[model samples]
Target: MTYIIGRGYGRALLTPDGIFFKGPFRRRSIPWAEITEIEKRHHTARSSEWWDLRLVRANGRDLAVPGAFTSNRYDHKFEAKLALLREYWQRAAR
Candidate 1:
């Protein structure tokens, strides 16, 4: 069984073969074999804040996990989830 973490109303799941993400508007799966890179992006301007987690595939497509961020200065839970994803992704690849 895959381990899943709840991200607000969405969720991120790590399975034996891939990663699964479900958000309000989109759902995505990235097989370990197809993943070329994973990245975290953040942008803050004036009163707005944005954070995204992106997975780059070997076929040149990118899948993003939206709503994985907060405007608050300390988001330990968010950071932990991102770290967990990275760690499990590496493990699945191996």
Candidate 2:
């Protein structure tokens, strides 16, 4: 399954092996066993509040699941997406 992020430009792909992320400039793959944490992150800039995901790896790398466009303000089903991601992580992570 795949989750669209930030106006459909970014995405997170979930598979039996792990999760994959592709953004404008970077790409990352995290195996289920290597994931150490999955958490929601809140960012505020001036008058806007943004919600995104923070995934930590065993090697201490952090990955963000984009929830909104860089030029956009409102979140798009952030809580729902986060919950779903967590569900997958819980089932797969060791």
Candidate 3:
């Protein structure tokens, strides 16, 4: 099974093989074995506040899954989707 989440200019696609990220101008594919960590991080800018999923690779590179962007209202489904993504990652890691 595959799961996809996100809106606007970025999205994250979770699959049994890996996680694929589609950003505004680039795309990244990280295989399950190459992923070292998956974390949720809080971000605050001058006018934007949101939370995102951060994927850390073995080579020390970080990728942000920007599905939780909350510019005006909160995205209530963010946590649920985050949990689902983690589940996929854990299953692949095993």
Which candidate number would show the highest lDDT if scored against the true structure? 3
Q: What are the per-residue Cα lDDT tens digits for candidate 1 across 1-94?
A: 1211334456677887888878665587768888888887787889787676777889898766544666655688778767877887889867
lDDT digits (tens) for residues 1-94 of candidate 2:
2344342577788877888877765687888788889876667879776566788889998776654233334445665677778888888855
Q: How good is model 2 by TM-score?
A: 0.72
Order candidates by TM-score, high to low.
3, 2, 1
Candidate 2 Cα misplacement greater than 4 A, ranges: 1-8, 67-76
Q: What's the TM-score of every candidate structure?
A: 0.71, 0.72, 0.73
- Weakest 10 consecutive residues, lDDT, candidate 3? 1-10
User: What Cα-based lDDT does every candidate model obtain?
Assistant: 0.72, 0.70, 0.74
Q: Which residue runs of candidate 3 sit more than 4 Å off their true CA positions?
A: 1-7, 46-48, 71-75
Q: Which pairs of residues collide in candidate 3? A: none
Q: Which regions of candidate 1 fall more than 4 Å away from where they truly are?
A: 1-8, 24-26
Error of 1 at 53 (Å): 1.2
lDDT of 3 by residue, 15-39 (tens): 9999887866668788988888888
